[model samples]
Target: MGNKTALYDKHQEMGAKLVDFGGWDMPIHYGSQVDEHHKVRQEAGMFDVSHMTVVDVTGTDAKEYLRYLLANDVAKLQQKGKAMYSGMLNEDAGVIDDLIVYLMTEPGVAGEWFRVVVNCATREKDLRWMSDQTASFDDVALTEQPDLAMVAVQGPKALELAKQSVSESRATLIDQLSVFQGLESEGWFIARTGYTGEDGLEIMLPEDEVADFWQALADAGVSPCGLGARDTLRLEAGMNLYGADMDETVSPLAANMGWTIAWEPQERIFIGREALQAKKEAGISEKLVGLVMESRGVLRAHQKVVVSGVGEGEITSGTFSPTLGCAIAMARVPSATADQAEVDIRGKLVPVRVIRPSFVRNGKKVFD
Candidate 1:
């Protein structure tokens, strides 16, 4: 048995195939992963993402502390409810974890506050790092919201179907929410952010009420999806999965996450800024790029990527793209690798085309 979310019984009742993911017993699929994946891409689907870790930071120094903790600048969030994605790094500039932090309080307020959602597998280490970084900031405090549950409703019709499950006031707010923005109302944090490369909302509400909400969405005809579909959807969207794409030993520059770092305000320093700056000065040798194979074969992680004359690399995450009808991957390769590469599959070298990391967006192929 593994740690179960508040909706464990609900998932079982829906005939979901449950699997252990990072110590949590999660639904891998209800009946068909391919079907579920198509549902999210072509129509609407909901995923029980309650196992994700949610933490709230509040106090006199919350903003300053965050600005000092994350690689991306939270100071850039000039309005309340705005969210930004960032990587929390160690002293060596290696990615400790990647997360989305929302500015919960009005900008420039004395009571600085923010909400951060992190990967559940890195809960202990991320929390410890966050706490230790706050040692110098006497006014900051961390509160974990273990009592909350999350659900992600995604696809083109996701917003309409999800709105049918919430209160009228919330529905109105959900309609008004802009992409990458999150707001709190009636004890719920509804954000228009998702991992599936579709228009969606990730709502965090009380655990006690989440089961009913999930059922309500089901009654409204929203498909209940699981982790298997979630993985393919995110991978197709070119989003990086922690532990697979990068970790404590990999630099953000090599993870296709360099855009997430904030380099300005040279005087204001974050935890790993110095090391990252040093890396920048020394030069970046490797980069993460996309791989596309137009054959009838599936791609899997850890496959060797041989860039002829350049060097060897490995696929961090790979999957048969449901939206593109081809195998797509994200691989870490030598900085000079370009245009073409090959993946070793069962001792056979299969040629692949390398392009920008993104493969699909809004159910459309993004690469040329």
Candidate 2:
């Protein structure tokens, strides 16, 4: 009896194994999650990401408001359709959420708009925070776009085959999209973005038109994947899982997300700036890094990690990497941790290798 997306029926029709995700009944997998994972790496796959919250921001003060709201500077977005990834923080410098914001319109355009996509589970608090911050800006407005449904088409042939599923003109538009840019056409927002660590597009269109589009992609030979594959794929790509890797209690500095924080210009005071500055001055004691247990067993979240004498840490997200054919994990460990560590697996302390936080990219091992 959880909330359902507009594509819920379609997922059921395709024999998806539905599970509760962020209060929504979502497909965990259609069949054989490992097989589906390989499909996306080898060819193309489509996922129903309609449950993600999309909010549109506009008005005269929109730009200024965003600059103050996110840790990253939006002033760097020079042109329309460009997108940036950022984290919203509380006054204490804890990560509220990680999101992507797209500059919807350029300067002097009719409507200076920005679109933000946040996690489905954190929508309520995220919206509340966004609106509360807007109270200082009289002209700013936030519009929740529940009428839109999103689908992420991904893999090596993702763009090429997905283009054939849409109109010829839309196909041409897709070809023009760069890595992180997005554009609107015929009421649909097509963005060159994805979570699978592969080249792909996330298309937001009217909910009514989504079923037809999804079916067309299936006709074009794109496989229908589910959350199980999605999680493993993103993990292989070294992307952080919200609740597992970070939450309201964790700072971005400890979550391997320090790169997302923009600390320049000194004057741009966003929420959590003061606290994050103090933390930077104090030094980060722990860090998020990649763990490789290539021997036999799989690594999982909540497993205790021992860094010999430094201290203990815990795995945030871990699994058997289908692409790498080995077990990999992201763990928060003592900053002093180096090449070797041990993970407590089933009361047995198993040795592991510590490396950079990424494992695979473009179907190959990336970490040294």
TM-score of each: 0.99, 0.98
TM-score, model 2 to reference: 0.98
Model 1, position 311: C-alpha lDDT score? 96
Model 2: colliding residue pairs: none
lDDT per residue for candidate 2 within 1-368, as digits (tens), equals 99888888889999999999999999999988999999899999999999999999899988889989999988888788899989899999999999999998885466788999999989999999999999899799999999899999999999999999999889989999999999998889999998988889999999999999999999999999999999999999999989899988888999988998889978888999999989988999889999999799999999999999899999999999998888999999999999899999999999999998888776777877
Report every candidate's CA lDDT. Answer: 0.94, 0.92
Quote the positional error of residue 121 for candidate 1 in Å: 0.5
lDDT of 1: 0.94
| Residues 38-86 of candidate 1: C-alpha lDDT, one tens digit per residue | 9999989999999999999999999899999999999999878999999
Q: Distance from true position, residue 267, model 1, in Å?
A: 1.0
What candidate 1 gets wrong by more than 4 Å, as runs, is none
- The per-candidate count of clashes, in order, stands at 0, 0
